[model samples]
Structure formats: C-alpha cells, structure tokens
Target: MNSYSIPRFTMVLAGVLMGCLAMAAPDQPPVSAEKADERAGALLAKMTTEQKLELISGHNQFFIKGFPELGIPQLYMSDATQGVHIRPQLSNQLEKSVAFPAPIALAASWNPDLAYAYAKAVGEECRAGDVAVLLGPGMNIYRVSQCGRNFEYFGEDPYLIARMVERYVRGMQDTGTMATLKHFVANNTDHRRRTSNSIVDERTLHEIYLPGFKAGIDAGALAVMTSYNQVNGEWAGQSRAVITDLLRGQLGFKGLVMSDWTSVWDAEKIIKSGQDLEMPGKANIVKDAARLLAEGKVAMADVDRMARSILRTCIALGLHDRPVKDERFLAKFADHESVALQSAREGVVLLKNNGVLPLAPKGTGKILATGTFMEKLPRGGGSADVLGYNAVLLKQAIAETYGERVTFVAEPTDEQLKAADVVLLSTGTLDKEGADRPFALAKADEARVQRAVSLNPRTVVIVNSGGGIQMTDWNEQAAAVVYGWYPGQVGNRALVEVIAGLTNPSGRLPITIERRFKDSPGYGYVPAGEDVGKGLKRGEEMAKPVYPIEYKEGVFVGYRWYEAKKIAPLYAFGAGLSYTTYAYGQPVIAKANAKRGEAVTVTCTVHNTGKVAGAEVVQLYVRPAKAPVPRPEKELKGFAKIPLAPGEVKTVTFTLNPRDFAYWDVARHDWSVAPGRYQVLVGGASDRIAGEASVTLE
Candidate 1:
C-alpha cells in the first residue's frame, strides 16, 4: 500500500477553453451502475485492509510517493474561494485573499451568469497553480447577522443563494478543476463555531439552509465540505441525517464529502455518516479509528467502502494522470481575473441615486470624497477576511476623475467643505479582531460626517459595511446615500459609475440594514452560556438564556418587522434607488386558483418616467391572506430586474408556486400552504408597493 502504487484511469475527454462545455447529455448512458459497482469491488479486493484505511484516513501529499508504482497523481488543493492563495505556508501567504465583496454582494446583483463567469476565472487560477480541487464558493444562507462568516456567504433567501451557487459550481467544474461547496447544513453562525450547535427547526432546515447545498450538488459540484458547527444538536461533520440521509439519499450528491480543517471529533461517527476525508492534518482520533478497525470495534469493510468512495471521487475528478497544461490554456485562464473584477462590480448595490451622479456634466461640481473608512476599511473581520489584491478607494477614483476639482479632503477641512459643491463621504468598519461589532457608528466619523453635511447639505454618504448598522441619525442630512459593501477591485469604480450614473443601480438589500441591533430576529432570544446547551461559556451560567443582545425593539426582524408593526429603518430590504423613476402598474394574477406545483404569474407594466435610463428591480412579495400560523407580513417569493430607457415601458412578470408561498411547518416536518387567498404585491422597495393582486392556492 505504498502511496505511489495507486492506479489511474486515463480516458481522454473533450473540453472547452473557457471550461468543459456542459457534460454532453449522457452521450451513451454512463458506465452502467452495476458494472461500475463491480469495477469498484474488484479494485477494493486488490487493496489490503491497511491500505484501505490509509486511503480514507489521510491525504497523499503532491509529487511524493502518492502511488510510487501505481503512478496515480496525488491531487494538490489550494484555497481559491475568493482568490488564489499561491503560497503554501500561512505566514508566506498574502495578507489574505482579495477581500472581495461577499457572495451576498454577487447575489444582490441578481445575475447568475455573472457568478458563473466569475467562478470560471477562479477555475483558471486553480489549473494554473496545479491545484486539482479549489475549496470555494461557500454558498450558505445569511439567516442571521451574528454568523461570523456572514460576510463570506450568500444572503437571507434560499432561492437567491441556490440559483447563484449552482451557476458557480458549473463554472468552476467546467474549467477542468473541482469546486468544493462548503460548510454544509445549518452552519450559519460563527459564534463558538468549532463547538457551537445550531438548534434549527427541521422544516427551516429543508426550506432555507439545505436548498443551496442541494442545488450545488445537482449542478455537479465535485465535492461538499462538512461544516464546523452542529446541526440540530448533531455535529454537521458527523450527522447521518445531514450527510447520508438528506444529501446522498434525497439530493443525490455523488461527490466527495470532506470535513473542514480540524473539524472532525469522533472519527467513527463521521466515517459511518459518509464523510470521505479529514482535512488540514489527520487527527489523533483517526489513529484511534485505525486501532478500532484492527480490533472488532469497527468493520474492515467500512474502511474499504470509504477507500472506494475516495478513489471514485479521484477518478471522477480525472486526477489519475499528469495534468495536460498548454500555453494557450494558461492564456485563457488569465481572463478569469478580469471576470472577477467585473462580477464584483455588478454586485455593488447602489442604495441611492440622485441627479448628482455619472457627475452632472463630469466637472460641474467640485466633488469632495473623503474618509478614513475609505482609505483603510477592510471587509468583514476574522475568518472572512481575505488578504489579497482589491481595488482602490472611492477617494482615489473620484480624484482620478476630477483631478484638482475632486479634492479628497482626507479629514474634510473646514475650507474644503465650504468650497466643495458636493461632499461624498465613505465610512464603515474593517474586518477586525473583535468578537462582534458594537451597535453604533464610528463616533469620530459620525461627528465628521455631521460637520461636513452641515457645511454642505449637498453631501452624499457611502457606507462600506458588511452588515446592518446604525443609520437612523445623519440620514436626513445627506442628499443621497449608498451602501457599498466590500465590492472587490473594481468596487470604487463601480461605486463611481453608479453615483455618476454610468451603470444602473439594480442592487437591492440582501440583508435588512436595521436601525439598531435590538431590531434583529435573534435579539432577545439567542441563548448564551450553557442554558442554550452549547457555545463558549464565560464565568458561570445566568438565570435565564443570557441574551448579550437585549431586544429593545421586539418582533422587528427586517422589513417585515418594520412594516408589520409600523417601525421604520433607515432603509428596507429590497430597497435601492435608480437614477430614473419607475412607475408600477397594478399586478394582475393570471391564475386566481393554482395547484401545488402550478405557477402563479404576477404581471405588471413598468414605465421609466425619469430623465435617466436605468434598471428597476420589480420585487414580488407573497402574503398569507388568511394565516393559521404566524408569518412575515409578506415574504419575497420572486423578483425581476428590468432595464428601461427614459419613458420606456415594459411588462415584467414573476412566477411562484405553493412552495414559494408556503410556510415551513415543523409539526408536520414539511412545507405547508394554507389553501386560501394569497396576496402578490409587486414594487420597487418593501415600503413602496405599487401593484397588488390576490391568488388562491387550491
């Protein structure tokens, strides 16, 4: 069982320069399952029990005796989720991979094609770097803001994350490399991540968290990495319900399932649950597992089965031979970097638009772009911080555009604010070593912004935040406001373009930017200490669930909480502005009565009535007309972003099913819908409902 003696299956397969064209529709059915099984069994018969254990227990390092005689190439993997980490050692690596706008930024763009294009570029880097598997594309729902990796994941809604993730998987795999969809199943929060248990309702599990992982699997993800946290009390890495039952049995995931770095605890539990590999380094628990197999504690066949699974995965990835590399191939891969920049640009949400931008007449007003936040602010801190290349700041871009006219008043001098025609201030926190962001604006900047706005009412503020922040104050002082999250390299350019009116601002709020932390869903009830039964305990247990965050504003989670009980946020989810004004005609429901899987098309005629040509996101919300269960006032079922020219009119439509309007019923362990009237409203923002229609689900 020498590492170098493994066998390789080399079959020439045609591929595209961009990536593999979608695997041709099963040209001749796949190697029959029965035959493949037999082949696997025969391979297993040749391997010694010890050898089988080695294959499943630890990874064979690259270029070593991976298979000394068998000539099987040991696959090399690199962290290229956001950008390629070329250096092997932690210290040798860049500050971090490029802190690109989180995936939610891309999802906000509402362009799956853009995501695919970005991932394709990521694939090229993987091939160039000689890495076989690119551990990327973390597609999870940002169910709550407290999740430490929130900035690394896609957003709140399942459909939004799933659609984008599927495209990313296809794009990465298409490029002749494997993409690993990560942190599977209810692994949202990062608080005490290594040992934290996510106690989620089962229905919420299926409807929200599981959908994205399923979609990625369906799209042919080469691997799925288990999360660090526990799901429904069982560790995600060792949960049979999550791995074998749901992923393999229900979703039909045929790829490798590996654990997060240093995430495995009980080795036998994980192996039985279908986890194919342990990461970073093989743990001591694995050695114990080896001893268990040698004894009667675990079966020898179990090791053989895991070994076969790993081999199958390797064969599927085509890593059995020397990788074919060409200069032309390298050149094609370079296009990927640009694709990343472009995708990042598209993902930049334009929170507000006024006549002041694509800069009215370019140099009409002397623009003052200033702020310490713009100069040094990074994306979300801690694990999510990608230390790598990114774009210049808004101040730099603005100066480049206007030269002397665009004075980047670093600290906003009194004379500068007085002289400036318009003030554009960039402000927010960087990803730092804090447990969580305190609920307040940076005091110094807040004071500076107030002073600047008072000096010039024509001021516009661009907040570079990864999550919601306190914006209730100083909002009215500014003429226009924009929430520009960690938009990557071309981020500043994208912001400039959106502000200057070059690109239409279609990016909507993926997470609600609540006025205060007290307005969040996890506000009062999130358990801390031992009472919740998990997470890092401090000194001692409190009397009740010690909510570090007290719920001052109860029941106000997002736009629902705001609209439901008449509370107002600085901005609402699905709220963003365009340079042009859009008029929404009342929506007409084609089918007043629809079946479970039937599509309910809500159609509305939208007209661009403003001077500028722009894009408008027509949001479709579904509300239970007669609810037996508590529900959000209206949930986003479907939405369409349409481009319209000045005075141009277009009919935009959204289709939904019973599932889209249904509530996750934990009691029945399924998604259920009330067969009654459901309201379908179409509009720009959550507060601005311009069109409405009623449909009955039968």
Candidate 2:
C-alpha cells in the first residue's frame, strides 16, 4: 500500500494517542520500544506502497492547495517565531496574528521573562489563525554574516543562546502552539547553505552549535527543522549524526524533525535518517519509501516506523483538533511594550565613560545630536525584519529624555560642533546579510566624527549595531561611547535612563569589536561571494581568484583571540562602565579542593565609593595554573550583576562547576578536567581582572 494514501489524519490521530499512552510506561526496555514501534509499523505495513507514498508526498488539499489526497484535509502550518509573518495579501493570508520583536533583540535582553512574554503574545496570534505548527524560533548559530537569515538567530555565545531559546520555546508551548526549534545541527550560514558543508570539528559542534537546540528540546519543543546546510559532510536533512545521533540519541529529543522549506535533497535518505516531513512541497519521500518496502529493498516496518513518527509529532502538537472559526485570536494578542522596553535597557552597553556620563546637570548642555542613525534608523534586517511596528531612535530618545531645551542636528557641520557643550553622535554600521559587512563605518562618517571631535573635544558618540565595528578612527576623539544594538520600540527610553544615570549601563559586549577587520578570527575565511575582491565591487566578482576569507586566528575568537595575541581592542568583551566607581577586594575560593562534578564558589567584596548608584557585572574566570594543551589567559566561567548605591558594600559570589573549567578532550571523546591549581579572577571584563584566588580540582 502507498504510504501517502494511508488512513490520513484519522489513523494518524489514533496512532498518536496510542503512542502517548505507551510513552507513559516507565519500565519500557529498548526491545519493548522497538517492538512497540514494530506494532505501530504493522498497521502501516498493510497499506499498498502507492497508498503510503501518496500520504507522504502531499498533504490534504484543503490546507495545501493542489495536493489532492482522497478528500482528506491537510494540516495547517503557519510561520511564527516572535509572531506570524502572514502573507501581506489577504487572498493568500494563512494567518492573522500580532508579530513580536526578532530573536536577536530578545537575546540582548538576557531576560527570560521578556522572551516568554513575547512568545505568549505570538502564540495567541497563532491560535487565532488556526495554525497548528509554528515554523520558527530559528536557533541556528550566528557563525557568519552571509547567512541572509541572521536576524532570526539569538547571538554568538552558546550559554546566552541557550537561555533565550528555552524561554522562547516555553512561551510558545504554554500558549498551546507548537514551537519548532530550527535549522538543526550546524546550519549556521545562508551562503550556499543548501549544499555547503559546515566542516566544524566535534568539540565546536557539541559545545557551540548544538547546546541551544539541546536546551530547547529539554524544554519540550515540539518540532525541529533540519537545515539546508550539511554537517561534517552529510546534509543535515539526511545526516543521521545530526538528526539521529545528536538530536535523538545524545540530546534525547523526542520531537519530530522536518525539513526547511524545500530543503530536502534526498527523500529516502532523509526518511531513513529520521526527518519526519518535507515542508511546503510534494516531493514524496514516503511514497519512495513505500516503493522500496514493496520491492523488498527496504522492510515494510521501516515505512511504518516513519509514518508512526510523523503521527506522533502531529498528535503531540495537538494538530488533530478541528479548528473553530472565530477571530478570538486578536484578543489574546498583546502589544507587550514592557518586555520590549526591558530588553532595550538591559541590552544597551556602556562601552566607554569618563566623568562625563549620566549628564552632570539635569536638562543640561546643548547636546548636538549628529549621525545618520538618528534620521535613517538602523533596524535588524533580513527575512525576520519587521516593517510595521514603532521603534525608538537615539535622536527621539534624547529629545524625549532632555525635552525641548535639547538641540538636535543631523550630520552636524564643523561650526555647529564647536557651538555645542556636549555632542551626541550616533555612529555604526547597519548589520545586514547576517553578519558585519565589509564597510565598517564609512570613511566619510569617520571624517565627520573626526571633524566633530576636533571641534568640540567633548563629543560623545553612540554606536548602533548588532555586531562589532572598527572604532580605531573615533575612539580617541570621543569622550564617551555606548554600544546600542538594534534596540526595539522602547530603545529611546532605555537610552535616556543610561544617559540620566538612572540606569547604570551594565550590558556586556556579547561579541568583541576589533579596531580593524584584520583583527577578527575569521577575517580571511569569508566565502568568495562576500569578498570585496579589493575594490572589485559587489555583484562584479570574477571566478578566477577564489579569495577565501582567511581564518588565520582560528579558535581565538572574541576576546580570547585578541587577549592571547596581546592585541589591544578599543573595548574588550564583558566591557561596560557606570558613573560610579567599584573597588574589588581580593577573591577567595570557597573550597581548596573541589571534585569534578561539584561546584566551587568564589567570593569578593565590591565597594561603590563614588557618589552615584551604579550596576556592575562581577565576572568570574578560571585559568589552569598548569596544563598540557594551550589555553587563553582565562575563560569566563560565571558572572553576576550587582547594583549598589553610593557608599554601599556588597559581597558578590560566583559559583562554578568543575565542568566549567574543563576542555573537550577529543582524543578521549570526553570532557577532561586537568588536575592542576586554577586561578579565579573576579572583576569587570577580560582585561580588568581586579581580584584573584587559587583553587585545586582533585
């Protein structure tokens, strides 16, 4: 019997309910699990290979037009991450829902509460549209810039990404909308993504690329989307290591795996590897699988197992429930302005400040606002970029905060710069094409900043961007500078708080900013299409010279790379400052000898001696005093954000597990803790280690 023509939604629902009930059993052995699968497979095995093939090839025509299948209705799938991107034209309008902020902005907030709030609102919007499965919360690593879909990603670090992904998934699931954690495995970039192989080693793949998805899975994400890119050498859609070995075997992901939109390359391979569904297309992997079964090349049990897997996912997401026709989804949709505002405040980093910040006088000094970012705002771009919502620009933020007395000027003239007591110049590149582009702050803008600095000498410039920038030209010229990535609607208000000294900027730079492009780890490893070809220009590339972006500084990424090279950056990672001063006492470890699995605590006293209230991030780093393999000066193990008023003294403590200090020993295929004395440094950023203590792991 054809797998495509199997009892459709009716039997799928029955299978799902049975599977759920069976899953409740605790003492189930592997043989029992396989036997249960075989039993489920038996039902599918009775159908003709052609019938089974039809069910797999096309969904019901009611939901997906043109794919007719025995009068059965297709399951309604919708697009949603923060919210649904419904087709703008109503005729093709599949969903009508309230959209939320992109994930990248959410990651900056570092607040799970905001992530849940945003997701709940999006889920409400989804429910109204009768969308059963939401296609997103795209959690691919921001490996490179050419990935046209980076706006959907969270950030660079694995821990930060994990936090955001878990919250987002929980939010969507809470609203009864199935959240799909997507682009499974190492599907990092979009350049040649469908076929390009991500040649990442095992350690990088496990630690960095897979953790967020692991977190989402543990949080009960219903589905996973296999990416277009290949991992190691096999396509993620078909790679057993990615789909079976890692996602299912290691992470224990019980959810169904689906392909990206038309991302399927091999039907039988994907089906065998455990990809449950091929998205938005009628390419029949199930039918092909059924044929293989009838031909005796593959067992009928295999086809049954695949069908049962798809049925289980549909059941788990509760897709079997019939839709109720109503517009009630609108009421569930919330604007969620508070969450957006909170994210912006926490996301903005105070990179450089000298006594000039927190504006000495209220409603003070003629602030000459200059920079293109003020007028032509820089928004997170690409497939996930939202066009209709309200946003707060720096100019608007300053004006609202300082009131009518503030003077606003765009692209300030040299004379205008001299007349101002304090100049606020908003500068930085608008990140597009996934990562930072070739032009890091145009020379013209740099000259404008140079001229402004020469005139006022009290100029304060703010960098607006998602990633880092080349600050070599303007760092010396500016009195203070802030890094504000694409802050959402309440960005203006947050900036005002930091400026007024009401909210001390405590955001750590998620990624490092190099003084020049030459300083980046993957500076030379860029794809041929991304290369400017030394003034050859965009869209005029010649095939002859394949200038691969040289990744000379391998594994020395972020501050670790720059620190090891002793190359100074304009600002370091975990770098932020406040109006008040913080003094750190000598660090002391809680235990002298700690075991591998146990956590070691470090304590330090921080005193706010200055006359202003401020917030500080007490970063804890651990370095092996002696080790065989090379290591950075230190690796960030843990951190705590503490707020203190003037004259306030508080003890900030950070706890670390031995695994935090361990490195992946690929040779042993396990995380190894080198037996040695380790130094614990507690301070601000990587460069400012103020307090130190030593501990031993036994």
Each candidate structure's TM-score, on Cα atoms with residue i matched to residue i, is 0.85, 0.81
- Top model number, lDDT: 1
lDDT of candidate 2 over 1-698, digit per residue (tens): 00000011111123212221222222212223354445445545555555555544435421322122332235556664655666555344533343344566566555554566667666766677666667878887655433445557776666667767887787777667778888786665544445456667766666567778988887778788887666767777777778888788878887667777656657667667866666655665743665666677666555555556655455444443345223575554334444445556666777777657766335556777777677655655654454435655667777776775568876567788898878878776655432335536677877777788778888887876656667777688678888776665556666667766666665666556678766655555555455431322223322233222222343445676788888887777777776667999999888898877778888899998877665666778778898777666777676666767778999987778766788767788777889878999888777889989898888
Report the lDDT tens digits of candidate 1 across residue range 335-435.
Answer: 44445445555566656545555464245667777875556644655444554454576666666656776766577678888788888888765533123
In order, the Cα lDDT scores of the candidates are 0.65, 0.64
Q: State model 1's lDDT.
A: 0.65
Q: What's the distance in Å from true for residue 206, model 2?
A: 2.2
Off by over 4 Å in 1: 1-42, 58-68, 88-100, 321-329, 353-355, 380-391, 432-435, 524-566
When summed lDDT is taken over every stretch of 10 residues in candidate 2, the lowest stretch is: 1-10
